[model samples]
Every structure is written in C-alpha cells, then in structure tokens.
Target: MSKAAFTSDSLESTFLAYTRVLSQYREYWDFLPFAQFDSGWSEPKVAHAMAQLTETDIEHFERDATALYQQMVVLFPEVKMLPVPELRTQTRPEVPFWLHTGIGGRKLTQIQAFVATLPTHATHSPQHENVLEWCAGKGYLGRFLAFTRNSCVTSVEIEARLCEQGLAAAQKFSLSQRFLRANVLSESATIPFSMNDRAVALHACGGLHTTLMTESVAHAIQAVHIAPCCYHLHGEGQYRPMSHVGRANDLGLSREALKFSVQGMVTGGDRIARLRQQELSWRLSYDSWRQVHTKDHLYRPLPSAPKSLFQGDFATFAQWAAQQHGLTIADTEQWQPYLAQGHKLSVQVRRIELIRHVFRRVLETWLVLDRALYLHEAGYKVQVELFCDYQVTPRNMMIHAHYLS
Candidate 1:
C-alpha cells in the first residue's frame, strides 16, 4: 500500500458503516441496578411494559430521534452564541516553556517515569533499527525509547517550538534522535520519511493517530504501537466510524453521533476528575454569592465555560464570570456560610460517580473497537486485553498488534 492508494473518503465511509451496525446491539444498552431506587430501571423492561399497556408504546420508543432533537434545540436555543475558546493560538507559549517551571518540571518527570514502564519490542526487522514517533510532543517517549532500546528515533511534530525543545532535550541526553516539524495532516509532508522503521505513538489525540495508521499501512511499516486519545478531533469534526461492525451496519453516521462516540470515551477516572472540579467550582461560587445575599436560597446552575478556564483561581474566576453574566456581588463576608453547605457537594459527587460507573463498560467497548479496527486495517494480528485490572487505572486496556504481511 502506498500514499497514492489510500483514499480518505474510503476510510470515512468504512467507519460510518461500522458505527451504524454497532448501534443495534440492544444488549449494549442494558440497564444496571440503581441503588437509590428500590427497583431497578431497565430500558427493555420499560419498553416491554409500555407495549403491554399501550399499542403505540413500542412505536414511540422506536420512533426516529426527531423529538429528542427538538427538545435539545429548545433547551440550548442560543447554541450559535456559545463561547468556545480557540485551543491553538500562536501567541500562547509552547508547553516546553512551562516544562522548565516547577509545575511543568514535575509533570514532565512524571510522564518520563510512566513511559519508562511501558513495554517495548525489538525493531520490526533486526536489520532496520530506526523508530518513528508520531505526534511526538516534546519527543519525551522518543527520547525514552532511544535510550532504552539503543535505536535512533525520528520524532515528528507540528509545533516548531516543541520540535526545538525536543532537539534540545535530545542534545542534553546525547541521545540518537532527531525532530521534524511538519503537519501530519498533509500526507506529502509526512509520508516520504524513512518508511522501513518501526512506529509508535502514546495517546496521540484524534486525527494524528489516524494518520499514523494510514501512513504505516501505506509504507508497510514493520510494527506499530499506538494508544489513541481524543477521538472527536478529526477533520470531519466528529468520529467517522473506522469499522463496518455492529449497529454501524445500516445508518450513515452524523456529526452528532460522532460527538456522542467521543463523549463515550470518558472513563470513570476522567469523570471523577470532572466531577471534583465541578463540585469545587460550584462550592466556591455559591460561597461568593451567599456573601452578598442574606437569604438562604437554593443554588442555581452556573453558566458554562471552556474546561481550560476551570483551572484558574475560583474566587477570581467568579468575579470575572459575574461581569460576563451581568450580575453584581455586594458583600464578601457571607462566603463562609456557603462553604458550610457540604451536603450538596457530597450528593452531587456521589450521583455523578454512580452514573459514570454505569456507563464504564460501554466506553471501554468503544475504545477497544476503534483500536481493533485500526489494527485490522493495517494487516496486523491484534490482541485487546486489560493492561491493568485495578479500578484506579481502568482505562489501562492495551491493543497489541504484530504485522501479518
């Protein structure tokens, strides 16, 4: 297979067909026991009971999702006005600058330690010992691999600053590695590189991993180890199904379906982090609001902002958010009273965790299927298994593949 032979449309169509088939597995949607309610809630049971009592029950449940769409539109009418911060900015300093900062140093060291434990394999062919790191951010993994395996590495990155930082690190360590700054999205820019080398990508987000798969197969790269993350960031702005398996059989996948598929990748651990951050933010906001108002009132929902903004100081953030929402804060002393409201935060966290637990299996299934399809397309013998059994690392599933051709 060559770059000239790989068609993006063909890959997109194949993925759309796979998702349509996957949607039909009613068993996949089975309801788990809800501890709060004495009786459990089951979708099939509810559908069956409704059908027994009314002639239109089954039809209503099976109806096209038109009503659901209308309800969503009404609830979020000003969707076009929603503020989404641009993630890629030329003005924003590259991650390497932060790496030298205390917090960044700790993060980089932690990542290096983690990568050290990941398993490695012999060069695909004993004669060709080079390795290619796809979307290699700061080339951390590439440096580690080169040091551990005593092999030369060529790391590809789109950001020039990242490439420079990686090169600096390589020089510091005196490692046999080189960094190339180029957009992986352009096949011509990336594919002509040394084709016989092994390839690896650890948690390469979205389309970056997909390009690796396409390129690896086209070049007949000997071996590849990839762990994909952020499935929703493709050129299509949604998950284009990669396999023709399951409910993806008949339906043409929509952008919304792709979004749902991406959301489905969030694991129990990820949800806990989200829940904790949400609870902490809410607690801080409520405290700030209560200081200005003496009345004991129920808390209202907080307005939404990009996830990155949530990392800042809560009190300062509240003040900034208040101006945006057209609200005024009069008193700052009653903050203690709102901080005393512990029950709400506890209940919300518990509820969110329970919901996450119920959805865990489905998310894992989607992750496995996506990796399996990528390996299958690459003509590899693939095995999917739990990389770790501990609940703390449930997302430790690994897709191991060996070349079949």
Candidate 2:
C-alpha cells in the first residue's frame, strides 16, 4: 500500500482500495484489545516492539494517533497507505441571538456547522421548498432551519416531551415549524415527507440515520443532509453493508467491530479521565484474578456499575463486581499485588489498542462510503464530506445527496 489519496479517486476505486487493504489485514483491527492480554501478533519481533513501549510511549501514542499510525508503517508495511480523505469543514452561518439562547455550546456549534451546508431561505428553490428534520430532539435543528432558511419545517421525533417543547418554541418564535411525535423505526409512524422536502439530521445514531435515508429514498424526497453517529447502535447486532459493492465485498462487521470504529473520540476533562483509568485498572485486575482462579482465561463482562462505586477504592469495587457475577475474591492483603498487576495490564492493553486505534477512522470511512455509494446506486448524486472540523466532533462526516433528475 503506497501513499494514495482516496479523495482524488472515484468512490468505487476508493472503496476497492479500502476493501483490499482491510481484507488483507482483517486480523489486526477486527478484535477487541481489552478482551484478552494477548497482543495476537504472529511475528515475535512485532510483539517485542510492543513490549518495548513504555508508559510514556503508550500515552504519546494514545494522544496522537497520527504519529502512532506513521510509526506502525514500519512494522505493518501492508497498511502503509490508508484511504482516509482529508475532511473539509463547511462555512458556518451567522446565528442569531434568539437561535443561540437555550442550546449548549457544543450542540449549538454542531447545529450551526450542520445547518451551514443547507440551503438558506434566499437560496431555497421550488424543488426544495420544505425541511424535514429527522430524529429531532427538542427540534432545535428544525427551528434553526425554519428561522434561517424560512422553509416549511416538520420536526419528527419519538419523544412526546421533545415534540411538545419544540412546538412551544416554534410558536414562541413565530416560525413556520411543526413537531410530530412518532418513532422513526415503527412501521406505523407517519412521516410528513413530500417530494419537495429536503430532509436533514444532525447526528442521528445508527439505524435512526439509516432509516432517514431509506424513507427519503422511498418517498423520492428532493434531498437529504445527514451526519451519522453511533455505528454500533443498529437494532440488529451485526452491520450488513448497504451498497451493492459493500454487500459484495462483505466486510463481516460484528457489533464489537462497529463499536471499535468510534471508540477513539476524546473523553471529558481530567476528572473523567482519572475516573475512567481507575475503573479500567479495577476491571482488568478483577479479570486477571478471575482467570487465574476459574482457569477460563476469557473476558467476562460485568454489568455497568454505578458512579458511586468509584468513590471507594479498587477492593470495594471488586467486591461489588464479584458479588454481582457470583464470584469470590481472595483476602484484601493479597489484592495489593493484583492491583499493581492490573495497572501494568492496563498500560499493556492501551499500547495494544494504539495499533487498533489507527484503523478507527478507516472503519468509519468504509461505513460512510457504503451509505454514500448506496445513495449513488439509488439514482441520487451523493457527496460525502466532513460537515465540521474533527475537533468539534469526530462524527462530522456528512452525506448530502439529491435525486439525479
């Protein structure tokens, strides 16, 4: 794999490149690093290279994925080049004070970035007269589009509470916006999409966004603008490809693999980071201890613990976790070494994950391209590009498509 920019290539060519490379090395990024302590590298030299990484090296790799990815080219030359596109950001619109009122800083930023790519009130043509905001939470996006674009807006959301709030806000603002409460996934859900409507969704997760495209295609809607998130939240645990090329290639994406694609997003502040590290250390220690006693040598998932569990130390958390799983722990005195061992394992796991993290964007690109190619196959002219800067949101890939006619 030499350096090749997929952005300059055709969708089919880019898809083929990713498929060939990913198929060749499916063993690397397709598995969970935390599930087992084994690095699973066939080459002893690769294993030795990983073992040589210190905590500082691990931290550096985790923080800067690009640097790590470039370094990985030395070991895995087959993946020397990737088909990741250079993402482009849309020019943001000047939002009114009224529009910015209740929205959080991040949400407002994302909404502005998303809305910027859409047709404004002055630019709305006869073919794209109305707006349909799918999975509208409180209809903030719908209201923004209605006010800025002056389109007849229909905000469809599952939650009655959000619909009511959105309706109230629309009325207060005197905007031509209506909120409809209906589940997008339900067969009986009435969607008010007309041929002249341009459907938009900011960050509809998994099947929610998929449903948007399916419904839009079925109704022959004028256009669709969407930024998809949460690739693993599909109703079915597995990801079947949408395009003919994708279906033919058949990447065999499990739910775990889908989840792995989006796991590289930045976490919250220092407190959250510390708490996460603490939890990881405890969980790994327990797994290591359990494997020794039970001789199963497999990862056993524990139920999500309460935040309050973290206020106490590792031993207390382990006790609660063990009781939940019908397992017993050794004496508290014996736990000290295991706690240290867990920390050591945590560093090792993080190092292992650094290699896997390089493919995070690659997997996401494949998924996004699958959707884009699906639209293209359905007689639509589709453009897949970044709607916002990656710093604002890693899930910034937007699919903007319109009927070929």
The digit string of per-residue lDDT tens for model 2 on 366-398 reads: 898888888888878877777677778889788
Per-residue lDDT tens digits for candidate 1, residues 1-405, read 011111222333433433432453322222221112112334444333323433132123213233322322232222212221111111211234423432254434433433433444443436536788888888877876676566688988889999998999888778788988888887445544445467877667767887787777777776666655565566764345555442344234344334443343223464555655455545445544653454544444455665555565556555655665466665453444444443344343333333333323334345445556666665776544443222223233344455777
Q: How many backbone clashes does candidate 1 have?
A: 16
Candidate 1 off by > 4 Å: 1-40, 43-128, 191-194, 246-302, 305-353, 386-395
lDDT at position 402, candidate 1: 58
| Candidate 1 RMSD to the correct structure | 14.6
Q: How do all models score by TM-score?
A: 0.53, 0.89
- lDDT, candidate 1, equals 0.50
Global lDDT scores for all candidate models: 0.50, 0.78
- Candidate 2 residue pairs in clash (backbone atoms < 3 Å): none
User: What lDDT does candidate 1 reach at residue 66?
Assistant: 31
